[model samples]
Target: MLNNSTTLVKGIGNEKAKDLEALGIYTVKDLIEYFPFRYEDYRPKEIQELKHEDRATLIGTVQSESTVRFFGKKKSKLSVRILVGNILLTAVFFNQHYLKPKLVVGETVTLTGKWDQHRLTITVSECKFGVLDSQGYDPVYSVGGNITVKGLKKMISSAMEQYGQIITEILPERFLTSYKLIERKLAIYKLHYPKSFEDAKHARRRMVYEEFLLFQLKMQALRKFHRENSGGTAIRIQKDDVELFISNLPFPLTIAQQRVVKEILRDMESPYRMNRLLQGDVGSGKTVVAAICLYAAVTASFQGALMVPTEILAEQHYHSLKGLLEPMNVTVELLTGSIKGKKRKDILARLQSGQVNVLIGTHALIQDEVVFEHLGLVITDEQHRFGVEQRRTLRNKGQNPDVLFMTATPIPRTLAISIFGDMDVSTIDEMPAGRKPIETYWAQHHMLQRVLGFVEKELKKGRQAYVICPLIEESEKLDVQNAIDVHTQLQQFFTTYQVGLMHGRLHPSEKEAVMKQFSANEVQILVSTTVVEVGVNVPNATIMVIYDAERFGLSQLHQLRGRVGRGDAQSYCILLADPKSDVGKERMKIMTETNDGFELSQRDLELRGPGDFFGSKQSGLPQFKVADMIHDFRALEVARNDAVELVTSEYFWTSPEYKSLVMFLEEEGVLAGEKMD
Candidate 1:
């Protein structure tokens, strides 16, 4: 079904097929899965029944039509007064000259849009001329690129009629029956053209479940494969060495940090190579716990490498670890892409000769030429920043090296287990002593004066502040200003203080310079993108202002808030968010109510999705077209349980029920770390 192209369907010629392919519909099965993004309730309503902001469809006869008022030659406004029974309903059209001629006196038409009760009018974005009745609950596909909505609907109808029966079901029938799931064929049919809201809801449930089930099954397969292949002779843990390193610390480890260290040590002592995830909130001292484990590996006559997402993070970790380890006679070195010429060769020689016991670097550590002498342990700091292949490549440098993955993403326990089932997870939930919870406030656009006044007050106290702008998608124009614009505006606002700007487009050296200036308090206010959301340590900064806070996920907002409250003085996190939606306001409300990273993460998963939780390129989650990790989380749990049971049962590999599923998972390439299917 997936192999056959859409060109085979009736009415879809080569030129039309090209348009369909642009919408990601290439095959017959692809056309079938191209479900509507939304279902418009075109069921006509009475004129008096329409409330403010009600997206209503009104069916009535055109009683009168105004002369076309031209704003431009192609752009004109027409006000049509439609009579529904005795009441007159207004329909306004903008730039639709073709519709003006069609709206003659005493002609029936259906129009749908948000109704303005005060004005008693509705904008006619979508309208259909009819003689009889209105179409109820119409499918609304995202149509563009020369294919009209009617044309796309006709193509879908043709494809379904010709090839719907041949569409193979990937889920096993036995498993579906056990779970009481809706049938695959029925779900697909109802998803595209459901008669009622309940039917659409059930169809969406089934499809979302199928998406999660396939992902979990592949992850389970990958987990099995990794355990089989990544196992090696374990390096014995040197307790005395770990203790000496821990004792050298200026501060004591929190109970959470100590517990996580023990878990890592235990995993490394096992015969199987350690594949563990170190999770903690910001300022949770997870790095120190990782340090202890790396020290243990070094003491056991094995070289260790720790790679971070950014050079700033790498430099921070290097200076931090070097200050602690070099005093103990452990040779620690930093290797990055910037290290070149004689300096790069010297570092490489030192690594090969085991002169550097603990090597910490950025992306350069994973390069093929940077070979190690006895690379027994590999650590990836901020694991999600690096892709799947990168982690595997770094691990392959050693003969089945022990892998320790670290993240400050503060994932909920259930989500962590569901997504990273391939690795054992250890979380540090407690923060170090002397840290304070950031004082959070939610404000609107009108409160800009008061919020900036607060920032000025803080700056006057000789402290610094961070201003972060929401990540704007290139395709979507953000209503609020961007980082550079905000920086420019704030410069004039805070003329007495120095302000700096940082964004993704800045060069590496330029970014380092800006960050260095900010850290040194030379720049009293630093305006940056989400790049400063993690691993940026400036204890002097006591204020964080996020513009358009509703545009970001709760987890990211929480991380940004964490930038402050690291110092002794009280810090403030002011959110300048004025969302046009109630849902967006609700997200901001959640941020004001909690400071717990775990709670925020769980709420974030519920409010949106894991895909939207971070940038698409950095989320580290498999791309599932239907499954939203936020709303369809129950499906993830169900899939995880079912996958566990299926692998334990005899039907995992040999049964006909699993054939199409296995093939589909293999085709999706969901698991890239040492390929499972």
Candidate 2:
């Protein structure tokens, strides 16, 4: 019955059903579950307790008959004087002349509207004949497209009345009792028609927990399924050989890097596949750790593949890894979209014949033509840039190869668990021994001359500087510096130095050439957008200037700041902006105070929320109707723990207690390929 079409409701016709469909409501269950965005409190308030512009409900006796005055065209204003507790107040209504008969002198009336304390006026939005009901809260749904809020409320109420009892519970009785959660049917009722704010809170809590628990259960099942059905061939490499390879490196690994490498190697040696995320700050040597893992796989006569989001990153890794591994008789190959004809054919043939011990490329690595023989290790740099399907495709090329995802964006532990719960996470928290922290400063636009002077000084010392702008071209609505304008100005100002501009609009080859020039020190001052946020490493670049830094999020600013501070020289990141909002100012302040990407990411989550933290498209975070990943983090933790416990126990999906949960997961398509039995 709950799955019946919403047309079964009392007042909904085909057209009205179409309108409801705009809100993603087609079935009776969808209608009932469409929770209100907010609520309006219509409880009667004392006149003395009312503040200026307060939306309040008041009960009073009519002191005078309503007077109707004509306004513009069909518009009319109806005003009446009402007396309550020796105070007289004016209640005005617009185009409600029909209510004049009800507002008779000496009659009691209840009204809800915006109050003007100075004039003691209530601009009535709603009027009733009697005192307010005990249930004073009215749920406000976000409605549109010919469907008024009143109509949506009516349809939802009808759906709830007819099918509320048929709403099945996904959570078992034990969880409800243990967590002190209300019944699903009661929770749904309270969510749509709450008597008080507390009732709404309780109902929202139940829903949030339910959403989080189901999500976590899905994650746990994924993790379990990946582990059990890994089909991984354990690569046996001696610890002594791994130690020898690490010792052979020109630079010693940091303690954090060593620990993470150990974790990766252990997972690789196990029969179960390695599904791990390698999270590190900018220049924290994540690439080195990945290189070491690739070496381990290659030494065991297994091919390794590293996929990055961009061709520049792929090229960067190709050069670095070739330098590191070529001396050890390890063959490395690069495969990207730009590589074509004979060269591309040669690389593909080598990859299939297992001659290419390690292959690095962009999305080209996931193409159908790219095949690997004895492929044992798959590493994706900046993993969030690729979708889940893209990563799966690369992994599918090999039979359950150990997969390592690398990202410079430091996600907070809470978010990492929520988003990457299915994978084991490793963080390289420590920077290299001699690496200097990037000195960040926030300056107003008026101080551009001073910031430029500082950049000139750095350039005079034979260092490169990056000038970042939020926009590629001039935006009329936004008063922010653009890359093209900034580049032209910088070129004119610093005529002696080469100033190159790069943006997303530039062709891939053009962008790569500009990056190469900047990396080779041919370009002294590079004016670019956030295109330089990742993979462009120049040891000589020691200064970064970001115009309109307030336009960027905290994590983004942090990423832009990371463009510099790659070398031993003292690096500086100058943020130029006069932020209007307190949040923008806070973002600048936070950036200047610390260079910890993890700390900045946490603050970014707080300021921008999880949706905008990594961006919704790349975030891999689930969109929950009631549960906020940041605010309800504690509930998520609880849900994850409970999910892990349940999935690992004897009574998992096969048990009668979890029958509803299995059904729900299957319906949600979470168990699409899973063996339920």
Candidate 3:
């Protein structure tokens, strides 16, 4: 029955199914799992109870209605007046002509919005034609495409009624007894149209717990699979060689970097495969740690490859690592999409010949033509930027290579333990010596000229600056400053200095060229978007000015701020925002207070929620419908423990009691290439 098409439901046709498909609701199971993002309380109140700032819902009869346009054809309004008992309440709706027919004179309707007592108007942000009472909380689903909110609700209700009998409970009885989780079907039933807030909360808890459990179980399964596959070429620990490589480096390794290098060495020498995350804040010497790992592997008579997200990052790593490793007689080669003719051919040939001990490149390293002889280790920078499939493909090039994932994006300890539960995490918490923290200041629009002057002063001192805006070009719908407009303004202010523009829309070569100019201190100022948030390192750029700072998340703002202060020169970050706005004020305060990324990440998680904190997908955490790791962190801990035990237990592999879970997990795409049942 769950296999039935949405067309089986009343009022749903081919067009509706196509729309539903856009939302990934292709079957009965999919429809039920597409839970509401929020709820709307439909409790109606009397007109006499309405106040100036009160958000209220009132049931009344329409006494008068008219349409008016203020500016153009697009600027339309539907003026409506209704009588609740003897009190008259007016509602003004802009550009919503569809309400005119439904809201006829003498017809009773339920209108919900903020009341304007001075004008005696209630702006009709939401209104339904028929008068209705509260059925507790009405769920508001995420709907788009050609599907309307009401239409989605009706179809989901129909699907549940028709297929509820076929909705099998996958969680075993032991889980229910141990965890006190609500019944699966009951949770689904009440979650869609909850009887009360209490029931909704319970249902959400059950679902969230289940999602985290499954996610943890999947990770454990991947871990188990990797362990069974046997690590490719384990590189034994070589302390003297690592020390020599560090001593030969241009800069001294910090205590944190030295500690992490030892940790990585331990992982590489282990009999099992190494799945480690090397996390560090900006300029925390993560690259240096990765270099030590590469050097360790190469010295053990094996080849190592490093993959980055962008060509510029690849080039930076290639040059930096080459300067240090080549002195030790280790051959380091760079290969990228931009490399052409004999150069690319030579790099590929060297890799196959096992002559290139260390290879650095972008996604091009995963190409079929790029093969590694005696490939012992694979290292990835900003690993989240590459998808699981891409990483898997790259891993396939070698024989179960020891994998090391490096990221500068800081993850709070709580999230790291739960998200990267299967992998060992090593953090470089200390900055290198002589590295100065970027001095941050919050500024309003009035400070634009002052900030420009500071940029000019920095340029005069022979240092470069980066001005980051949130947009590429002026959007017709948004009011934020775009890079293009900012670039134009900055060019006028810095007449003698070069001001370059770069954004995601720019061509790859153009972006590379602009970055090179900035890195060489040729571009005095580079005006760009958050595309520079990740791995474009220019130590010469010392000043960072962000426009409309309120629009960016705290973590993102921190990343943008990281672009500066890479050099020894005292750098500054000027955030331009409205100082009065709550989000703006709070963000500015937090930024100016500290340079601690983990602390900022915790605050960011608190403010933006875990799903949006690092973004659901990019953080390598699977999407959870109602579960928030920040709010339900304890639940994640409980689920993770239970999942780990269950997945690793021998009983789970052979027992009939777990057959349904095995089948469901496989169907749910959590098996990680391992089949069950």
The superposed Cα distance between candidate 1 and the true structure at residue 130, in angstroms, equals 8.6
Worst 10 residues of 3 by lDDT: 668-677
What ranking emerges by TM-score with the best candidate at the front?
2, 1, 3
Model 3, position 226: C-alpha lDDT score: 62
**Highest lDDT model number:** 2
lDDT of 2 by residue, 262-290 (tens): 89999999999888999999999998898
Whole-model alpha-carbon lDDT for candidate 3: 0.84
Q: lDDT values of the candidates?
A: 0.83, 0.89, 0.84
- Select the stronger candidate by TM-score from 2 and 3: 2
Candidate 3 Cα deviation (angstroms), residue 281: 2.2
Q: For each candidate, give its TM-score against the true structure.
A: 0.76, 0.88, 0.75
Q: Please state the error at residue 240 of candidate 2 in Å.
A: 2.5
Q: What TM-score does prediction 1 earn?
A: 0.76
Any runs in candidate 3 off by more than 4 Å, and if so which? Answer: 1-168, 243-263, 309-312, 326-356, 361-372, 383-397, 411-434, 469-517, 527-531, 548-553, 578-586, 599-623, 669-677
Q: Residue pairs in steric clash, candidate 3?
A: none
Per-residue error for 184 in candidate 1, Å, reads 1.9
